[model samples]
Target: MTDSQDFSNLSNRRRMTALILLTLTVFAIGTAELLPMGLLLPIATETKVSISTTGMLVTGYALGVVIGGPVLSALAGRLPRKTVLSVFLLVFIIGSIVCTAAPSYGLLLAGRVISSLAHGTLFGMIVVTAKNLAQPGKEGKSIALVGSGLTVSVILGAPLGTLLGQHLGWRFPFLVISLLSAAALLGIMKQLPPLPRSKGGSLKGQLRIVSRPDFLLVLLITIFGTGGTFAGFTYITPILERITGFSSDSVTIILLVFGAGSLLGNIAGGSLADKRLVPTLFGGLILLAVSMAVFTWSSHSKAAAVISVFIWGVAAYSIIPALNMLVLNKAGDAQELASTLNISAFNLGNAIGAFIGGLVIDSTLGLAAVPWVASVVTLLGIVLAIWSVILEKNRKCDRLPEYPFENRTA
Candidate 1:
């Protein structure tokens, strides 16, 4: 074979391996990030705090992710993306071990922050890599597949970790997370191809996009879209225990149902976005709003709630791959920086949702009220989406550049 054809074959093999490694890495991160939710009750009891106070740990971790994501991406701007990803996974492993060994709540909190610092940067790098690996018109699907590790973790990891923690000790989840992260590190070392160094505008230049109208609108969508999911999910364990009357052991099963729905949604969203980006986002947001609204009533009926969780999963995660695609598409020349910042935006939304969910629960509204509020926020997100569409149309009519990713590649 000619040199070009040989290179093509090598590239295909390498990309496939990278995809599997990325998926495994995502699984590890997902378990670590979400394990706390399942163990919230035990954590609260052990730490001598209310669930709401313990919820701050969630907010704290997300805050760390937001802070760490862009800063790390910017700092690592000169390094190979693959190398940076490997280091970040190593950081995650260390953090997980620290969390597992922590003797106090404060130490555990610190460990969570450490792990979170790796979360956003790792996700940003993975998404970019997945985009590069994709064939033409397959970027969305590729991102979704890499991202599926997270959804599967939510469906499979959290429940199992939670069950193990509840049955053993609360720290067991962290130990499992640590092991998983180590495993991911091994896969990454074995499979990921050597990546070129990042090339982009200075940190200041990239940050300038914060003021751009299109970027801001998409950032808002990320905030609201992700925040809506957290508002319900952050408080999910309590809601299941109190409302659905599921025991600690049984909560895992319900979460599995939710995860299953989310995994399916993640795949569907990617494929659909590959075909038509805007319409898929619009539909996903609408479905999210409807499902969040139904969750309020569904919480009172186990059967309905189970079904609702499935739909809620779909709506919540479907927007993720779509949002990442949309932001990169809009950012034009600054795709990597924009992509990393979008991950930060998503984490910021997570922080917002957890805080809001806590405030609602601490108030007289009770746990069931959380989903209703989430539904309203999701409706507001729909407005943002519509506005974005309108703005894009006007911009296009005025001869502005849009769909910047149309000709863009990683």
Candidate 2:
């Protein structure tokens, strides 16, 4: 592989172009992973299953990502990142094709799982790829740019796919996804080049990060902090329509507001992350906790719901870039493993947060109580983040440990 410094030699235009393609690649992967959620009803209807059972298709995708991110990254540790990306994109494409033609619900679930296996690991590689190419002081911004694909998928792809499914049947959306992934595959093949991997790291050696209590604490924060977003967000449609008293017809407009907030918040957070990692993260979580509280109150008024959901979107995503940067820093020499593990942490949080919301609904608290439960959970994250920040500050009294990496500015 060429020296990592070769990245710095590329002009700004080329760098931006590469980032755009990577963003689209991630966008495609994200769209496939989430497209199932939008088609749950139609799928359940066609496959002779209950709606709740079809929802498990989403659980299957998240599980695939949780398992695939770290495992796939570890097993492919020896391969060039470019090759890893290529093969995973191919896997995603094949998975989508299978979903398009699946003869049964079981087969459709299998295809979603197959496609999702590429979700986290490929995203891990994409982050490292973008970070490696970034100019000094731009790493957070670049990472956020790549991460924006997921937000865009929620905003554009999933909704459009849902619309297509309603019009042309559920199978058609997967076929569309297959076409999109094929384009991403060609983009990966053409736009990305061979990238170096850690020279001395082994999967077993990388897993040693699990033994470090300090890093594990950080991961815990990542789980709850990011997961807190989903706690309320997982049911935004119902919350807006049912609790906020927005007519069911206004749900799409509210959704667009929320998606717009996510995109803006992601970029704003990334910019802030570049300036100040700890303070920015702390502030983001603080605002996130506040936003959740705001939503709790805002859900009673229609106009308030719109404004609050938009702010909630911004506060929710703003912390991610900094949070992710913290993980990479904590993982030290095992940046790739740590990065992917954060992905797992994220998925785990989503499941747990959703469960928390579900519990609130099942109990006397009811659906209107969802954001209240989520707010308390987010406060826990804020507390943990504060502890981590203070601990890092005290540790600064001693010499910081060495973090290995190839020289990138060469």
Candidate 3:
């Protein structure tokens, strides 16, 4: 073999190894973020807090992500990417340890918020890093490769944590997460090559990118799309029990089905987005809307409910890769900040959707009406997506050349 060819092969192998470590880091991070939900009852009991107060763990984490992401991203902007990622992992490990040892509810909440400060920034950096490492035409797939870690966390990590908490104790899960984070940190430090510092853009310049018409529109699409899914999803357990007449065990199996569908959707979305960004976004939203609408009636039948739930999972997660790519494409040199803001946007949408769902359930509209509300919210996203596509076509947007296939009617 030629010397240059051997070097090229080695480079590819190293890149793949780095991507795998990043994916593992993401998985550990995701599991830590979601562990509280599965162990909420045990945590509340042990900490001597009400269940509602225990729920604040999630709320506090979300607030931290929104308020801290931009500040941290900007502050770390000039640091080497590897350094920033490693530091984030260390922060996560420390926070997890704090949670495991906290003697009071307030301390536990503090640990959660501290850990959450790394969530948005880490995701933003990881997405951008993966994109930079990707082969020219495989950017979407690379992003997907990292994103699958998060999806797998939902499917496997959280459930396993819950089981561990049930068998051992709630504290055990946090301890496990800390160990996982430590392992990921070691892998990142050893295997990942040094990445260059970001080109420092002025605060005003970063703000300008955030305020751009196209960029703002993409963020809005993310908000509405994510909100629509969580609207019904937040109430899924009750819906399955009361409306679908399923046993508790059956609900677990159905949720597993949903998670499996999300994994598939994440993969398919990335591959298609590489070829056609606009079309993939549109198709995902349309599918999401239709599935939620169908679910309104389908919930009456067990078999139909399971099928619709799977479709809902697929449609809900399928837009993520495309949306992340869109943010990077539009953010110019401020990709990290833009990506961080997008994560905040998603959490904002989650809060909004859950709030709206709660209001609907408390009112006369009730649980049965949630799917219809979800459909309507998703339809608004569809409208915005359509408007964005038209604007792109009229302006002959640069996205066309980026995706190659997007030059055709999206």
Candidate 4:
């Protein structure tokens, strides 16, 4: 549990404001992060690169997040949380600027990498900050609020950016995100209180977390489960066009439906995870598997496609808060370490998902098979999730103190 004093010090209104501000930060970053997915075609056309090459930009950003997260956290150790956050926002701003103004594919890719350097650290820090701001038991809700920020960007920002890119050019979307990032920075500075610096951090201390099989298994769940979501989602625009027979313009609107589902799912996941962590997690996995499998076949029908996408949206993001809580609990004293690693693992998963999705596209499987592959990957993740739960129970049983008569024969 967080120190009660931390939760008690702030007024409810201020805490809510902090949550809104943190969520906006996520929105700005999330929009920029995913903008490539919606604008993939335009970027490839204008940059004179193949679509496959454009896909690598997404992979590059993921790699940047994985690399930047730990290094930034280590460098900022014991620093003021607000100052560190400000620094990250500045890095994001610079990256967006570079991306927007780049003259060629190489420069655009460079800019994307710069912008992504802030992602992992920002997500990890904001989540920790949001949890601290919540009133004790509402930690999951606060984390979910942050998740909603990211999801809402998909709902609103990414699609809007996509719409804008279709009209003006891909560069324009990055420009719009740059403006959003500036507003988010101002809001975060004005609203967010000084948060406590995390303690007990060191490279050695961080690396030592992998020794815990429970923590490692949870990360594996993250890679495969969330990776499965990315497998279907990262290539969504193409899937809608080639299989569902939707026009590009219609794809934009459908993305909104997907985004709405994400918003609802984020809230439900947060609320339910706070209420009951284990059940919410298991249920979310089950929901994701079913949705992906259905989406594979449902792509043939326009109405069914919409329903499948909405369900996919809900099932996809709903697992985040529960998963984060699970990892935090399993990590014990190394909360920050676990949080940052999980953040990096998410992008690592993204890179893997994108790569796998690309292979499916290039192979005979084509776009129609993406959801099926995603479903299979996610179903496997469910098996790991169940194993983790059983492992946790066994670990707890092992830790029980021996009594005089209990287990005497054993």
Candidate with maximal lDDT? 3
The lDDT of each candidate is 0.82, 0.83, 0.86, 0.82
Clashes of each: 0, 0, 0, 0
- Candidate 1 residue-wise lDDT, 287-322, digit = tens: 999998988988888889889999999888898888
What is the alpha-carbon lDDT for the whole of candidate 2? 0.83
Top-TM-score structure, candidate number? 2
Clashing pairs in 4: none
Question: Lowest summed-lDDT stretch of 10 residues in model 1?
Answer: 1-10
Residue 114 displacement (Å), model 4? 1.8
Those runs of model 1 whose alpha carbons end farther than 4 Å from true positions after fitting are: 1-11, 40-56, 103-106, 166-172, 197-200, 237-252, 298-302, 361-368, 402-410
TM-score for each candidate, following the candidate numbering:
0.87, 0.95, 0.94, 0.88
Which residue pairs show backbone clashes in model 2?
A: none
- Model 3, total clashes: 0
lDDT tens string, model 3, 1-410?
Answer: 31112223337888888889889888988888888899889998888889999999888998998888878988885677889999987987888999999999998999999899998888888988888777766778888999999999988999999999989999899999899889889988998776764465676788887887877888889999999999989899999999999999999999999998898999999888888888888999999999999999999999999999999999888999988888877787687889888988888888888888889899999999999898889899899888777776666664443221233224
Candidate 4 error regions (>4 Å) = 1-4, 40-55, 166-169, 201-203, 237-239, 361-366, 400-410
State the weakest 10-residue window (summed lDDT) of model 2. 401-410
